[model samples]
Every structure is written in C-alpha cells, then in structure tokens.
Target chain A: MIELVLSFLKLGAVSYGGGWTIVGLIRTEVLRQGWLDEGAFRDLVAIAQVTPGPVALNAATLVGHKVGGLAGSALATLSVVTVPILASLALGALISRLGPRGNRFREALRSGTFGLLAMTVWAFAPEAARDPFAAGLALGAFGLAAFTKANPVLLILGAGALKLLASFVLA
Target chain B: MQASKPPSPLRLFLFFARISAVTLGGGYVLVPVIARGLERKGWMEEKDFFSLFGAAQSLPGPIGLNAALFAGRALAGLPGLFASALGVLVPPFAAILLVSEAIGVVAAQKQARAFLDGAFAVVPGLVAALLWRMIRTRAWNPGRVVLALAAAAAMILAPGWAPAFFFAAAALGWFVETPGTKA
Candidate 1:
C-alpha cells in the first residue's frame, strides 16, 4: 500500500502535461518498478477511458486498488492529482511575474505550446480521420458547435448513426 | 516585486470547485469555463487567460488539472494550491464514485447494452470534434500544422511511437529555443 501511494504520488507530482501525458509517466514508473507489465498498462488506459470519470483519475484508482485496495485508490488519486495542481499554480504564478516582457523565454514557451498542441492533435489525426464518413460527421459536428450551438452530444449520436449506415452501405 | 495581497484560499477553492463541478465537457472545455470564471472574479484578466491556456495546453497534462493548480497557487501559496486542487477534484470524484456504483446496475441489461452501443459508437466522432476545436484555435500556425501532420504520420506508421514522438517534439522545441542556441 505504501509503495502504491508512493508510486502514484511521484507519478502525479511529475506528470505535468495531462491525462495523456500521465499515461507515459505511469508507463515509465510502473514498468521501471515492475508494478505492471506493458500489456496491462495498455489495458488500464483502455478501461480507464471507457469506464468514466477522469481518465487520469481512473488510471490512478485502478493502479492503487490493484496494489492496495480502497485505501490505495484514495492515496494514489491524491498523489497523482494534487501534485499537478500545486505545480500548475506555481508555474502560473511564476509566469504572472514575468509580466508581458515579451522575453524570449516566454515567447519560446508560447510557441512551444502551440507546436506541442498541434503535434498532439496531429498524432491522433490519421486514426481519427480514418473513417471517411466519420470524418464528415466530425466536420459537421464542428460546424454545429461553431455555428448553431447545438449540443455536442446530438452531433455525436448523429455521427454514430452515420457510421452504422456506412458499415452497411460501404460493406 | 509589486506586493499585492493575495485572495483568501477558501474562497478561491470554492470558486474553482464550482467551476469543476459544473463543467460538462472535460479538460479542454474547462479552458473557457476557467477563463470566464477567473475574469468574473477579477482573479485574472483576458490576456492572462489566453497565455495560461497556451501554457497549460503546452505543458502536458489535463487543462483542468493545470488550471486548478494555477488558479489556486495564484490566489494563495501552498494552501491555495491544495484548496484549488481539492476544490476542482472533489465534486467530480464524488460524482464518479456514485455513478460507478450504479454503473453495475446497467452493465448487463439488454437495454443498457443497447444504449451503451450507441454511446460508444458516437465516441469516435466526439473525440474528433473535440480535437478539431483544439486544432483550429488561434495558436495554430504553419510550423505547427507540419509538426501535427508528421506526428500523425508517425503515430499511424507506428502505433507505439506516441510517447517518444510527443516527448521528442517537445524536447526539440525546448532545445531549439534554448537561450544559448538562439545566440
């Protein structure tokens, strides 16, 4: 239990990017520590996404529970999440002080963020764009969201139906 | 250093907790929510919101996680950090626990399965829509577009390359801009 909490604490403390980044952090930590094999870690990510709640939270809970039961879940979650919270706050405060200097450090951070964001999306694009019909649905959904303020959920349902129809027609 | 008094920690926590609890969509969506919330409270201004959005997205984790931590830390020091983090998390955590307990009731039924089939099917599109919004944001530029394309190509070509590619890109950006390198 102690180890589980400690692991999550470290994972949470350092895993700064987001849910996706947390996966990598967890992979490194867990695999290095022999906590879970790669296959199991992958399975955990899948299960975490489909199950509900925050993916990161779910990941932490599963890891903790597996190693230390309910108590482990609590500690793991706290460690993983709280660390980032403090870290973000600290970073934000630091950025505030730099205060509109247009310094290279700040500019670089901004540009890097844009690049990272774009790259992150780019990484997912192909698979996400794989189904032509799904792609159209995504565009239409984006349009609805951008223009009509339609509930995103509705567009999603519409897209799934489109996919189902495609399976029959295209197949 | 301009010494302005920081806001109360408890109030900041409550403010963020409300934001987290009410947010329907996940992390990215919280960007707008926090922006609006912070603006209304006078905790941060518009420029601050945009910069924070960029920094938060760039840094790596969930936007809400970063936002909560940033907002909390801004309002107070360590105590503010704890409050903000806890505030954003507790509501969602509690809600999930309740839902997860009830999730079993719907897990096996035919009707439930049918409902979930539809729900799961829509997920891919939902994911795409979310990605599109993030992609089309103002931060996007030609260099980013190329990086994105390459990243996508790499991910598709080798499904296992996500972490390496992402970190490598970040490292590239970091090192390329390192102060000494620029000079």
Candidate 2:
C-alpha cells in the first residue's frame, strides 16, 4: 500500500502537464515499474476516460489496485491529490491582494502561460501525427476554430460524425 | 527560500474554495479568470502570473490544482500550500459525496434521463472539436495530419482496437516531423 501511494506521488512529483502529459508519464511509469503491460495500460486509459470520476483519480485507483489492491488504491489517490489542492488555496490568498496589474507578477504569469502552451504542443504532437484522418480532422477542426468563432463542442461532434459518415460513404 | 509569516489558514481555504466552485470548464478556461481575479487585487504582477502558469503546466496534477499550489507557495510559502490544497479539493469532494448520496434517488428521474441522453449525444462532436483545437494550436505538423487520419480509421474499423492509436499518433508526430527525435 505504501509503495503504491509513493509511486503515485512519484508520478505527481515528476509530471510536466495535466491529464494530457500524465498519459505519457503514466505509460512510462507503469511499464517501467512492472505494474502493468502495454495492453492493460491501454485498456485502463480508455476505462479511465469513460468513467465518471476524474481521469487522474481513475488512473490512480487502477494503478494502486494493480500494485496493492484496495489499500494501495486509497493511498495512491490521496498522495496524487494532496499537494496541488493545498497549493491552490495558498494561491487564492495571494491573489486576493496582488491584483493582475502588478507588472513583474504579470510577466511571470505570461511567460508561464507561454511555456504551458509550448508544453501542450509537445504533449499533443505524437497523437496528431500517427493517423492521417485524425491529423486532417484535427487540422480542419483547428482551421475552423481559427477562422470562425464557432462553438468548440459543435466542431468536435461534427468531426466525429463526419468521419464516421465519410468512412461508410466512401467505403 | 524565505518563508513568510503564515497567512490566516481560513482565509486561504475560503479563497480557493470560491475559485474552484465558480470556475467553469477546465484548467485552461480557469486561467483568464484566475489572472483577472489576482490582477484586480494586485497580489501578483503579470510576469509572476505567467511564470506561475508556466510552472503549473510543468508540474504534476491538474492545472487548476497546480495553479492553487503555485499561488499558495507564492503567497505564504509552505503553510499556504496546505491551505490551498484543502480548499481546492473540498468542492469536488463535497460534490462527489452529494452525488453519490443522491445517486439512488435520482436513478429513475426524467431530468436525469434527458441529461444523460442529451449529453452523450453531443460528446463525440465535442471531442472532435477539442481534438481539432488541440491539433491546430499544439500539433501543427504536416505529418501529424496523416497519422490522425490513420488512427481514426483504425478506431472506427476496429472498435476498441486500443487508445494506443492516439498515443502512437503523438509519438509518430515527433518522429516524422523531426527525424531521430521523439516527442
């Protein structure tokens, strides 16, 4: 149980992005740690998304169970979640006084945001490249978004549906 | 690192809780809201704000939670981290708890029925749009264009083939776009 929690803590401790990057990180850790194989890990990712809870929580629980059953699941979950929750509260307190106009702080925030954007690009790169359709769909979707002020949700649904239609119609 | 005198723990807690409850959408969506909230109050300069955001992206955990931690640590050091963490978590925890308790009661409701049906209907479209946006802003490789299409084919043809299709797409992007380098 302790090991399970600690491993999850390790994941939280080292990751560079949110749910997105965590996917890659989790893949590396789970495979390296011998917690699960590629097949099982893939399945878990799907289930994690479909499940109602947060993706991280589902992942932690699954990893924990593989490592040490119910107890492991509980520990991993707590460890993964604890640090960030605390940090956000402290931030809230800080912000109440600083305001956005503070120049230095604002610069830091902008740089940080830029860095995040870059990282997100890094994170999504691999997924975007492997499949031609996904690539085109994403590009078209992006073009639509960039060019028009359309609702994002509509774009996503349309892409999925359009692809399905294309597959059958073209086939 | 110099630790500032601890701020009131309660103040820290309430502040984050309010942010969490009011924030719609995900972490990215919360960025502008948080920035405005802090900027208006004068607690952090824009540079510091961006820096924290960058750091948050690089950190493990949810972006929202990461923001809380960065803000807390900036405000009051170690103790602040603790306060913010609890505050951010309380809302989701309370919400989940409430939903779990009421799950049985709402299991047969008409509103619930409509919500489930309506929400699912739009999910694929939303995914498509988000996937598009993600590609446009982040995955702008010509090679990625090819992979995404292939993956989509694999997914539709072989139901439940594997999410590896997606990750594989990402990994392939790094290779195809930049030879001998993995993203």
Candidate 3:
C-alpha cells in the first residue's frame, strides 16, 4: 500500500502536460512494477476513455484497486491528487504576486503542452495507420471536432457505432 | 440571477460533482464546460475564471483535478477545497472501479473489440483538435512555434526523455518569452 501511494505520488508530481502523456507514464510505471500486464493496461486506457473525469485519475484509481482493493484505490486517488492540489495553490500564489509578468510562464507551459500533445498524436498514429478504414474514420472525426461544436463523447460513440456496423457488413 | 449570499460548502461541492459526472473527453474539454457552469452560477467572473484556469494549466498534474482544487480554494478556503475535490473525484473513482471489474466480460466480445478499437483510433484526432484550438488561441510567433516543434521532435525521437524535454521547453519559454526580451 505504501509502495502504491509512493509510486503514484511520484507520477502525479512529474506527469506534466496531462492527457495522453500521463496515460503513457502510468502505462510505463504499471508495466515496470509488474502491477498490470500490457493487455490489462490497454483495457484500462479504453475504460478510462469512455468514463468521465481525468484519464490519469481514472487509471490511477483502477491500478490502485487492482493492486490493493478499496484501500489501495483511496490511497492512490489521494496520492495522485496531492501534488496537483499543492502545485495549483503555489502557481496561484505566484500569479497573484507577479501579475502580468507571470503570463510568460503560463505561455511557456502552454507551448510545452502543445508539443506534448503532438507527441500524443504521434504515439497513436501507428494504430490508426494500421488500417486504412480506421485512418479515414480518424481523419473524419478530426475534421468534425475541429470545425464543429459537436460533443466529443458523441463523436467517439459514433465512431464506435460506425466501426461495429462496418464490421458487421464486411464480415 | 446571481445570489448575493455566499455559497455553502455543500453547494460548492455539488457544483463540481455535477460537472465531473457529466463532462467527458478529459481536462481540456472541461475548461469551457466549467467556465459556463461557473458563469451561470455567478460564483466567479469570467476574467477570474480564466486566470484560475491558466494557473491550473501551468501547474503540474491533471488539469481537471487542479481546476477543482483552485475553484474550491477560491470559493470557501480549505474546507471548500476538500469538499469540491471529493465531490469531483467520487463519481469517476466509483465509475472506474466498476468498469475495471466489468471490462473483462465486456471486452471479450468481437463487436466490443472492434468498437473500442475504432473509438481508440479517434483519440489522437481528438487530441490534435485540442492542440489546434490551443494554437489558435495563442499569438502566432516563431519562437513559440519553434519551441513546440522541438519538444515534439524530442518526444518522438526519445520517449524516455519527456520530462527533460518539458523542463527545457519551460526554461526556454521563460527566457525567450519573458517581458523585455527582444521579439
């Protein structure tokens, strides 16, 4: 239990850029620690996606549960959030103290985040590239999301439905 | 109709809980949803909300969780922070636990596999759209674009060096983008 808390605590602190990068970090840690195999990790990512809230939190909770049941889940969730809470408070203080000049720091972080997000796209590109149909579907989704105010949840569900329908027809 | 009276801790907690329960696609998506919710509730003004959001983004950890903490702290101090964080966390915590237990059964079917594969494939696009939105909101400058490209290249070429890359970018951004620096 202590180990679980400590591991996630470390991850929570360094898991910058959020989103997919955090997911990748969790995947690496879990695999390295022998807490979950690759298949289970994949399922966790999928589950994290369809469910609400931050994927990193969801993944941490699931991992905690897998490792140490209810207690583990509680601890892991707390561990993952502890640093973020403190960091936000600190950043808030810094912003108030520095005023407009602080804006540069935020901009820099945002720039770095853009890069990290691009890496996320790069990481996932191979999966889409494996199948031409999947690639086309992804491109279409990108266009819709970029141009329209469509709900992302619906877009994801719609893609799933299309895939199911296509598989049925083709098979 | 903005309420003159301050919101109770319970109200603050419930507000975030409701947001966390319904909003999807992760932290980035929550920005607008949260802004709208807070605006409608009159708990915060627009400028304050964005400032808080910017701080949340700049800080390490999950953006959604960080936002919740900031919102809670801003509203009711320490107790409010605990209340809001708990409220926002419980739903996802419960949902993930349930899903993790049931995933084995659900993932076994062929159709489920195909559906998940398809949904997963769209994630990159979703993220890309998010990046595009971020870029659009910012001033287009050579330095910013160059830094972003460098970080992305490092991330791809050497996955293990992500933390170092992010730190380097942050340092460079501080130096190059800071006030009084030559454009």
Candidate achieving the largest lDDT: 3
Residue B60: error of model 3 in Å? 2.3
Taking all chains together, each candidate's TM-score versus the true structure is: 0.64, 0.51, 0.88
- Residue pairs in clash, model 1: A12-A80, A17-B60, A17-B61, A18-B60, A18-B61, A18-B62, A89-B69, A89-B70
What DockQ does candidate 1 score? 0.21
Candidate 3 CAPRI category: medium
Off by over 4 Å in 1: A1-69, A96-171, B1-7, B39-54, B134-146, B157-161, B175-183
Candidate 1, A67-131: lDDT as tens digits:
66567667878877655655555565565455433233433333323333333334334434555
Question: What CAPRI grade goes to candidate 1?
Answer: incorrect
Find the 10 residues in a row with the least total lDDT in model 3 chain A: A19-28
Superposition error at B62 for model 3 (Å): 2.7
Each model's lDDT comes to 0.55, 0.51, 0.77
A1-171: candidate 2 lDDT, tens digit per residue = 655666666556433345443444465557767888864554454344333334555566667666765566657767777554544443434544444322223222222222232333333445443456555665665566566776544554455466556555655
Candidate 3, what DockQ?
Answer: 0.58
In candidate 1, what are the lDDT values of residues B109-167, reduced to their tens digit?
A: 54443333433333334444444564555354465456556654664455344445554
